[model samples]
Every structure is written in C-alpha cells, then in structure tokens.
Target: GAGVSQSPSNKVTEKGKDVELRCDPISGHTALYWYRQRLGQGLEFLIYFQGNSAPDKSGLPSDRFSAERTGESVSTLTIQRTQQEDSAVYLCASSRDSYTGELFFGEGSRLTVL
Candidate 1:
C-alpha cells in the first residue's frame, strides 16, 4: 500500500500480555499520528509526530501506551500489560507537513484483549 500500511490487522491477546502494532506511512510524509477507536466510538488521538519535533503524547490514555516514529517513515505503537479496556481499533495516519493537507489513514489494527 503506497498510502499507509499496518501489520497484523487483527490481534487477540490474553489480559496482561503486551502487543505491538506497526505502521508504515507514505514516503516523504512528515506528520504521523496514532488514534484509537472503541466500538461505536469516535477516533481518539493518541499521539502525534511531526518531523524532528518532539512528539505530542498528551492524548495517550495511560503510561502503558507509547509510540515511536523513525524519521517520518515507520511507527510502532506498543501497549504493555494489556487489559480488556485497551481493546480497540488502532488507526495510523500520515500527511504532508502542510496544515491543510488531508491525512491518509490505514485500515487500522483491531485488538481484542481477553
């Protein structure tokens, strides 16, 4: 996928387990973001990375969740000690540096904790 690519489209993990979700954005995109959506709920921003600037992680739900982006290319979202409440669709998006550009989103990785 030239737009955005995510691996392990669906995941089921035991409670207290850890999971990693990966994202590859379009080449040259300078902005990347991670969002979560629970069933029947709107997307909630988790983190944002733009260029060399420090990432904005204030939207993360807890300390157990974190994301890393390498040079605006690929990003990995890690969730530690997963719980049922952490189940959701994790969406990745990327866009050009311009503020007016539209974000290209991945199909999302669905996580289910049991």
Candidate 2:
C-alpha cells in the first residue's frame, strides 16, 4: 500500500499569498495528522483527524491555518495570507489507530514565502 502522499512538494510565494497543501493517507489507516517543520526545527503538530470524530485543531499556529479531511482518507491544509513566518515544510502522517505510537509520514511540501 502507498504511504502518505503530499502534493506540490515545493512552493514559493510572495507574502500575503494563500497556499493549499494536500495529503492522501495510506489505505485502511484511520488516523491522519498534519505537521509543520520550519527549517532546522522539529516537527510541529498542526492537526489530527481520526475516523469520523471531530478533528483535533489545537495545534494550529494561528487563524491563518486550517485543514479538513474527507472520507477519512484525503486531507488538505490551507494557509491564508501566507507570511514569511509560515514558510516551512508541511508534513502529513497516518497511523492504523489514533492511540498508536507509530506514524508513517509523507515527504513534506516545502513552502517558501518571500
């Protein structure tokens, strides 16, 4: 089965532009997550979607960030009015269950806001 998949692997935009990053989780996986990594920093949890439950959104940095998962499979993370501070690598991961300690990650979508 395919692991997590992310699109537009690299993006460059001017400040204030909006960007959308997409992710497709592995088949049969019920737990999906979104994380962000800025340059040399470690992964930052942004959001998590499990089955049909309400998404856990506490990790989003600000109002400019949002995400949604549909059919418990594919998800998209959106950034409004992108800023230089928003420049980072957005990563997606999925696990068999929400409580599991292991998550398979995608090759991140790198965003650069000029």
Candidate 3:
C-alpha cells in the first residue's frame, strides 16, 4: 500500500462483542499510533509504538483495549467486551519517527456498538 492502510472501513458489532482493527503503515515508518474519536468529539490517543522500544499504552481507556505491532509493518487494535461508549472511529497514524511530528493516517475503522 502506498499509504497507511486500515481494514474493515466500517464495523458494526453488538454490545459485549469483540472487535479487531488492523493497520498497515508506510514502509520504513517507525512510529505507529492508535486513537479513538467519539461522535462529535476530538481524537483521543490510545497507544503508541516506536520501533523496538516499549509501546506507550498510557492512553488506553481500559484494560479491555490492547494493541500489537510486528516490527514496523502491521498493527492491530483489539477491543474486548465492547460497550456503547466504544462506538467511535479507530484511527491509525504512522510517522518516520516519533520526532518527525508529521504523520500519515489511514481512512480509519468506524466501530458501531449497538
């Protein structure tokens, strides 16, 4: 993919169900981030992975949310026991490095929990 690619552009799941969103970043990008945006709200940082260093999971809303990345290629965000409040857009962004400040974002996965 030429840019950051996300899978399942839209997802509708029942409350308590689990969902997984995927992201494929641009080649050579070393920083990947996951964020959530509620309806009519701004993006909330969820997690950040920079190269082989420990992933910064500080922003995760709860223990039910988790993410993983393989090297610098792909990343997946998993939300377990979803709730109505979890219905939002899951966004993925990548940068050459955390210091660059410029990011490439994916189209995002819209999660609808009903």
Report the number of the highest-lDDT candidate. Answer: 3
TM-score of every candidate: 0.94, 0.94, 0.96
Find the number of clashing residue pairs for candidate 1: 0
Local accuracy of candidate 1 as per-residue lDDT tens digits, 24-88? 99899898889999999999999888963545799999999988887768899999999999999
**lDDT of candidates 1 onward, in order:** 0.90, 0.90, 0.92
Cα error, candidate 3, residue 98 (Å): 0.6
lDDT of 2 by residue, 1-114 (tens): 577889989999999998999999999999998999989999999988897454679999999998888877888899999999998999999999988779999999999999
Choose the strongest candidate by TM-score. Answer: 3
- Give the 10-residue window scoring lowest on summed lDDT in candidate 1: 47-56
Where does candidate 1 stray beyond 4 Å?
Answer: none
Alpha-carbon RMSD of each model: 1.2, 1.2, 1.0
Candidate 3's C-alpha lDDT? 0.92
lDDT by residue for model 3 (1-114), tens? 689999989999999999999999999999999889998899999999997454578899999998989988899999999999999999999999999899899999999999
> Which residue segments of model 3 deviate by more than 4 Å?
none
